[model samples]
Target: MAAAWHRLWPVLALGTALLLAGCDEIGLKSSLSPQPRPASLRVVPPTPVAPSAQSLDLARYYHKVQNDLLTRGLLRTDGGGPDTPYSADDLARNFEKIVFYNEYSSGDGLSPAQRLQSGQLSRWSGPVRIGTEFGASVPPDQRSRDQAQIDHYAGRLARITGHAIAPVRNGANFHVLVVGEDDRDFLRRRLQQVIPGIGPAELDLFSNLPRSYYCLVIAVSGAHNPNDYTRAVALIRTEHPDLVRLSCVHEELAQGLGLSNDSPYARPSIFNDDDEFALLTSHDELLLKMLYDPRLKQGMTADQARPLTTAIARELMGQQPQDPI
Candidate 1:
């Protein structure tokens, strides 16, 4: 399956809805409005409670969901191979679409629009501190596994972007909440603190997220500088199986770093909505590296960054196109 790795791209936020052309079997493509918990900075476990009927049902549903995706050979983790070989042009084009455009309308902040609109580049201009909180129903083992994966991923992100990124317990602006159906109230209370003055419409997502949305992330920037993300929150549904949950982590957390949109042409990568890759691929790593390359400043438009992206992609791919740039 070298055409590409399998993916399960979830709606990370208002940042972008890259594409909704495919992968609806699991509804992997989303255009929700956004998160940060690199992992377990405080590790506060919710009060233990019996699993509610909704929680149990959700668990079963997600169990079947992951099974179906696997059966279809989706969520591939191999990164990609010869059959999925891509050119520098492919990289640059995908980068332009994913990094410079967004899915959904920001005008309403609540409506999920299926439109692809141009947007400025957004990313963390400062250190990214991630912390995690889990619901009571989450077992200790699951917590440990999720935290370990996030920590490892945080390190990997820092290495890839040459930026300061880490999972912390204190002073975390990025909060990752792992909750289930039973934790709706807990999540509601927490969301108030995590996102002050959140609107009722957006509130519905955290308190009563739809089954269609497997996971979600919200990356927010200060009013003075929308390109510089200051805070984020990602909701990973505990109902999902381990692989799906981790896939949510990978896509959402990375999306929090500013790759907000999904592109259909982005093969050999998780940036596509094809559900072909479960993990970030070698192709995606180059996008991250190029994103934080220092030359592409925050708030850059697609046109402003195109030349640089092409150069970066060419260098990363070691390919020279016959056509002039």
Candidate 2:
């Protein structure tokens, strides 16, 4: 197990795939908007070091946050039973909302989700090679456990979407970083080395990340073809509790692939901001299947995908493809 330990420096936020929270939604690449300047990455080999006091405090705070959320009956992990049922129409509508909507308006930093409905279908046109990186502060055992979770989840996503998704150690197009607060300075430098053109304002997004926000993702696509994603990254805080950390994994990694927005009406779904479901629900799996269905191609508008998704949703639920809602 390899890790990069930080020197207890400050932080930075790079731009790419959209995030689940405000930070991600602001400038994450999507078919809905003009692509950001094309950027590439250079791997920063892992280094071992100790964590700072603030990182430890952040860990304790997140544990408390997780416990409080559980106490309030949030962050469910049951995959949603009958009480949270959705309809064929619901499924199709939710799929459109999740795929074709934008969270914040035009911006450079984190902001409240504006629900700007302007996104288009965008997914990796090629294989998705997922690579996991950890901060030095993370214990070796925890790193192993986290890597296991990502590996299994990648397999689940592959099975559902029938896409080439797997954990890799080289030539990865999607990078998932599990870092703590104290490692911010190192991260800033690392990303600066990886994405040399990353702006100061963008870096401040990480340097001054709000405590309310936990994790985010960034993606890159060709300027001419917004639908085709090439490179991406997901930032998952190591401080969160087990389930919450897993929740970040499920949501952000999926978001990095394509599903870029959230909808209030999406029941039993991780795509919803309500936090009712901690993990990807059965409903989410069906959505993934529908997303990769050959009928609905990338760069498709919601209007372009509506009829096709409805029909696909029917087939997924064992109903006749042409059945009326």
Give me the candidate number with maximum lDDT.
Answer: 1
Off by over 4 Å in 2: 1-24, 28-48, 113-115, 193-196, 323-325
Q: 243 in model 2: Cα distance from truth in Å?
A: 1.4
Q: How accurate locally, in lDDT, is each candidate?
A: 0.72, 0.70
Candidate 2 collision pairs: 10-184, 10-185, 16-218, 16-219, 17-218, 17-219, 19-24
Model 1 per-residue lDDT tens digits across residues 86-178: 888998999888787755554343344566667677788989998888888788888899899988999999999999999987877788888
lDDT of the structure predicted as candidate 2: 0.70
Please provide the root mean square deviation of candidate 1 (C-alpha atoms, Å).
5.6
Write the residue-wise lDDT of candidate 2 on 88-156 in tens digits. Answer: 889998888777766554542444445464666878888999988887767777788999999899999
